[model samples]
Target: MPASRCGAIRRADASENIWCMTEPSAWRRARAFSRGPESTGHRLTRRRRARMRRLAWVLLAGAALPLHAQNPVEVDAQHYRLEYEDKQVRVLRFRLAPGEKSPQHEHAARITVVVSGSRLRIEDTDGAIYEMTIYSGHAERQPATRHTVENVGSTVYEELTTEFKDAASQPPKLVVKAPPPPPPPPKKEEPKKAEAKKKEEKPKEEKPSVAASAPTTPGAQPAGTKPAATGTTTPTPAQAPAAKVQPEVAAAAPPPEPQPIIKPLKVRPPEEPNRRRRKSFAAEEMSEATVNNTRLAFMEQGKGQTVVFVHGAMGDYRTWQLQIPEFAKRFRVVAYSRRYHYPNPSTGKEEDYTYEANVRDLAEFLKALNAGPVHLVGHGYGAAVATLLAERHPEMVRSLVVSEPGFDKLLDEKRAYRSHWARDEIYNIIRKPLSRQNPENGVRVYHNWLAETQPWQQIDPQEQYERMQNANALRAQTVDPTAPAFNCEAAKKIKTPTLVVAGQNRSPNSAEITGTLAACLANSERVTISEAGPAAYLDNAKEYNDAVLSFLGKH
Candidate 1:
């Protein structure tokens, strides 16, 4: 038989053996041979047919499998185990023994927390190789990748990885190009052209029939009538009568006046009722004031009497975000991020990161604002600053609100000694982590201690992120020896209508310090906010705010 009669057969260039039969004749012949008798030739044909059918099914099954099934866990089950999975994220526990190598696998963008130290070699599909030494308890974020990992160290390499599914996981290859210009507007037709179009569209009139000219009786056929056919053919354009041409008087009409372009007005969306949009505290929203050649960032709102808020260590103007709107409703509120805090350039010198320097800055800041005798509020380290400022520059302060001031120097000899010993112990605990270049762990320990909480992991993630922004400042403060000492004498001099606020559940040290300061002040009253910790304002903002507002209203 010729090739056309038999149809064509082609071999596919695939890993799997695939035969393509182009016509129904080839399929019919194969099916017939398979169903034929068990002779030598028949058996051979039947066996070949069965093999092709099996191959076809195998190909379809492979195609049906999901692409994501080729992830690390499924590719190398021995090295990777699925720990947790949800729509937003997938967590996996991975472990590779000494001298062990894993098959090439893919991973989404993930954060890996190392559980054991190891030296490893990684090879990517693109032929690039990387060697790294990772430490136990170290964590880092990695872009989505496909690679083979081999542990070359003497111990097992183990890590817990959380892969993000919500965000773009793959590493980006950026290209810069100018945007394409917009398309031009459509052309409008002129009045003369529009008039000529109308004239061409006029319908033609038909000639009168001969039967109609010779009037016929009712229901009677005319002399020239013919029987009705299935259909009638109209005259072609060449056979049709010529159309009449109109005079040029219509085209002589003047064009109408140009119409004005009407533009749409933009209307703003209505804001949600009873909901105040919180400030983002972005760079643009911040106002800068230079005090003694040092630029400080602050946020101000409202009017009337001024109330200045100074944040402590590990915080910025954003710390008072909860209080700013509430206070601004009644008084002029100004909250500033102290020196060496987040979003501000720092000298990184330990000596400059002291409470005394902060006090000097506050004094100058008040003078620059010229908001005479303003209400002052401070927390933690900032509380000490406010106290020192009031004592030194009495004219600058109207009323003072100090919430659990960390001024150990105001304590008597025995209490001061105990405070120093506790401080040394804390430094000892954080020293190793800082030396290991993991400041987060150090900050965690310090934060837990100050918050009087056992575990730092329970803290809000947003708060943690904001606090980490000032990790450098925390490090500087940790090592600084020039921290200001505010004694009883200094506290006695600050008779600026002081309101010392303390948390009901505050640590013993904080209670003692706050009590001592309150006793030292000649004209001062003390109040405690219940269900709070060292940071009374943050822990119980409503009660703290009400207490402070009541005190401010009195003065």
Candidate 2:
């Protein structure tokens, strides 16, 4: 789409081409007669004619430009959902129904992560037709190309396209505007009256027709008829054929119940070995243990009293990848992905995830491991899960370490806020996206806010794209209206020794929340890890691990 690659070069090529046509007779005679050595029209050198033909071909190549002005994601919503976007990268989820064909579209150089199997028939601009079979998790690098697509497989075709936006830059003029025009606002409706009526009726509107105890998507109007979560597919207006034969959406099963606490058990805390640094902490293999009806995947190391690590939202057991190996050298360490996380097969079913559901899953897993008086370490949303479990089943937990726990209750008990609070300003960045029906952007906006970074950070595309995959997990949590709040009084009821790990970059309000939590827990202590944000484990593992190890060594 670069202008120099197209328009400017095309104009120059056209002008030179016209001159070439007009001067062909004169040029032919001159080439055959070289001033004094050669006679006119007697002979010509082959090399010059070949060079001219090559020049014409080069000019033709320069004239090629994008056929239309549209981005692939904006071009096809049902088939392509924006998984992530930052200054450096853009990740999109690509899906297609069997026999469906997409209109010709162009993509920059990208890497595709195939999550499901599909056979595709491609019709390239050069008129070549090719068929391909893709397996799950298959990664293929793609060059910039324009093409139409057809799903030849009987099964659905899905893959993740992670475009490295930094590979090249096009001039502003060459950047195509979207095809769809933005809708204008209605002039007839009185904004104030409509808003006033809605405010009065909102409470009644949010009530649900179906009664269910399962955690609802963050979008669920737990309070009243706000509306179901935004990401759930209804019908998109894009002209592309609607995909049929999607994975069946299953009704959420009831949350697992915590089994009766068998025997009270106590396990001694750690003295970790001072091991050398590892080459890489990326998991090469995983071990699995079944608890409840589901199989839980985990990693195990060391051999002492048990320490189970739980991850926050948009994370799996892998979130603690760096810390687990270090801790395993001293204490028996177990880190497992939560339900619906990587390594575990996707249910393909949608449900609102909640602390209660997570707690039930973890409790059963711990019981299955036969490790009680377990040292519990949780981060962010995982921290909330840990706290809830500790409060409900104190006997199963020995000590608790929660990092930057998120409970709406923290937002509610704000002595810092005057008559007006600015948190909503932060909240609305995400709200605006979700309200405008851009759920993926809403997820990224919230993550950017939490990390205390600009709306988009410049990082490796694969790294960001891998994390963007987690954005799908945040959908339910992002809009869950029925999410539980952090209860200070309930936290006070917890007698298990607790450590609250507060990161340095937290907002004053967040700092207060952690501080208040420490104050409430009768036997709790707070420690701050510098140069870290919501996830210290990821930002600076050694500092985070050392703090955690030091605290555990005492208890």
Candidate 3:
């Protein structure tokens, strides 16, 4: 073959073609090259074959390139730091100096919170470039993307980002709007004239009253009945209507006017047995109390001794949907949303989102109610607040019922460490999702981790919506650094009648904390609700209510 043709084929097939050309005999190569005058046809075929092989190799190499690159933290270590990570989410802190550009990287769906304002230029994989102006404290949710970032402004750009690891856990875009009013009930139709006349003519027969027909004395038989050998009396046929009335008088009376027949209204089928309906209180039924300069929304029912329900993080007065109705039958029931919870305006201050603040609010709330010392029932974080209140102002509390109080500080050194570790684990799992402004996913992660069963899926949609409304409070509590410590010494001081309730299937950390509290309280009794976890009241409402009510009755 000619030098140019041999060189092109060698480059295309590499060593194999070169070895074949060099090893072949000189005569054989000459014969193959001299197929025709200048071997034009042979040369053209070889060139086409070589080009096809080269194209195939190029395509294969292109296929080897990755569609998505490594994580941003791995690709740009100088600008990104892995702050936290778990199966559900990964949190990273990023900072870029002025005019600094980062290599292309990949990120999952994430929520970015701007720590410092700056102008940024983003270049996507498809070569699309966009400039964005961001401000400090601004947060926005982003979908999974591959891009390169550059700080185009004069100042450095900094942000904290939470990337969702599970696509299903991504927060949904929520739109707020008033729900449409329910449809009007179907109207009833009037009975036809013929049907009304038939019903009117079918007169109801008159029968003697039992009191008039029965014998007045015991063991006495009626005039038409005869006693049997077995001491059972057999009655003859009922007496015939008296024939004293004249036929002419009866025929003269006009037939009673046709009366309409009323049919029973149709009712919708009952919902699933496990599904709970949303409980709504009328405007007149709900009342508000300003406590500690915060307007607390509350609902009250029944009349007697006052029993106030304090809800935990991510809950409002509606958390006691089950308890309120059951308790209201007897003692007066009051369930109020704490400060920053749903239906209440949030000051957005970190200091107002602690247990101490909650306890102070509860004390002031009780004073405002002026219902005397009231029975206090609290759950989760609220349970801790209830205990603190009892310790600080025993005079304001009649009795205390705390279910699964999350006072990890009260446990022994070993148990406290384990509790803290578990808490951090859970926080890591939910922090990213919560930061993404997706309360529903946060709620799902937290509850799914706390219990073996899927509590989030089992709850009513209205209840889920209610929890999402208080998600900000939960987020604040999770990151609060000034959480008040509750040692056993404080628990020992609470001498009020107390019931420490826990779930039989509660997490080990929760069980330890609650058990420690129970051990420290001098006048406290502990009860466990079966088939329940951290949210015993929701898991087994009847059992939880009975236990709480039984405890309240004594105090």
Which candidate number would show the highest lDDT if scored against the true structure?
Answer: 3
The whole-model C-alpha lDDT of candidate 1 against the native structure comes to 0.65
Task: Evaluate model 2: give its TM-score.
Answer: 0.47
Candidate 1 backbone overlaps, count: 0
User: Comparing candidate 2 with candidate 3, which one achieves the higher lDDT?
Assistant: 3
Query: Which numbered prediction scores highest in TM-score against the true structure?
Result: 3
Give per-model TM-scores: 0.49, 0.47, 0.50
Scored by CA lDDT, what does every candidate get?
0.65, 0.60, 0.66
TM-score of 3: 0.50
- Candidate 1: TM-score? 0.49
Show pairs that collide, candidate 1.
none
Q: Stretches of candidate 1 above 4 Å error?
A: 1-284, 347-351, 428-438, 452-454, 481-483
What digit string (tens of lDDT, one per residue) describes model 1 on residues 417-475? Answer: 65675565566665555444346666776675565332356554445545555665676
lDDT of 2 by residue, 413-495 (tens): 43333101223333434544544432546655555545532223443333333344444455445444344555688888999
- lDDT tens readout by residue for model 3, 162-271: 98866443333333344345679633223323434554576553422222222222112122222222322222222423462235434432343232111111111112
Determine the C-alpha RMSD for candidate 1 after optimal superposition of all C-alphas.
32.4
lDDT of 2 at 456: 36
**Comparing 1 and 3 by TM-score, which wins?**
3
Worst 10 residues of 3 by lDDT: 261-270
